[model samples]
Target: MAELRLEELTAQTIVAARNLALKPGQAAFIAPETYVHVEQDLDPAGSWPRVVMDGDHLVGYVMGAFDADATEDFLKAALWRVHVEADAQGAGVGRFAVQALADEARRRGFDRLTVVWASGEAGPEEFFKAVGFEVVGETPYGENLGALAL
Candidate 1:
């Protein structure tokens, strides 16, 4: 394993973060339609976006949104997006990224962090659960709502 560190997503790293690869059948679980149903309504002010670096190489991206007043549970201190390169999957990149996000949430006075996933083969349901998020409920759109207590 290379040295893993989290960096604030900056202009210089934006392209690399956006280009992070995913395993086959993982595209359908990405934001704007599937797992992250809260993407369109996210407030930029509360967004905490970060990139995971493994010795100068971009390996993953994790985005969290913090909104204390969000009516939907998943929108508050939410796990907005997480994308890890296919080759790096299951090697702790995603877990490292999410732990950073959860730390940020704790700093912002949140007692928990929430995430939703589109359930199906190849979806990220197992990873989210393994990271300590329990299925709290289901979204109206049928996404699994998971909460990780901070």
Candidate 2:
């Protein structure tokens, strides 16, 4: 495999990103009902989204949110979403994208980066755990809330 790289979502790549194919039963893991956002997060400055590329191929996409003024600690700096192509699942694309988000959080001076995920078969609990996010709590919607201290 070529070295994986991150790219800003561009007009040219957006279509490919939107078409990223996940393995069967994996789509539900990336977007749990408990994911939260406020009007303030609408600012482009607060949302950090990147597309993962292995040479010319769009292998994955990841997004994170940074809201210093958020009332909840977990919301302050959170990993919003990550979606990797089915074929790239075990090739480190997901981990690479997540670390990039954590790197951004560290750059912004956040002490931790949080994420929420639904638990079940084909879910990302194991992946998030392997990335060093601990289960800190549960959301009102019954999803697991995880945090990785930087």
Deviation from native of the Cα of residue 115 in model 1, angstroms: 0.2
Return the top candidate by TM-score. Answer: 2
Report the lDDT tens digits of candidate 2 across residue range 67-93: 898877777898988999998889899
Candidate 1, residues 1-150, lDDT tens digits: the string is 787998897898999888877888898887635434446777789988888988978999888888898877678888888999998898998899999999999999999998878888999999998999999987788778889999
Task: Give per-model TM-scores.
Answer: 0.93, 0.93
RMSD in order of candidates: 1.6, 1.6
Q: What stretches of model 2 exceed 4 Å from their correct place?
A: 36-43
Candidate number with greatest lDDT: 2
Model 2: lowest-lDDT 10 consecutive positions: 35-44
Q: Which residue pairs show collisions in model 2?
A: none
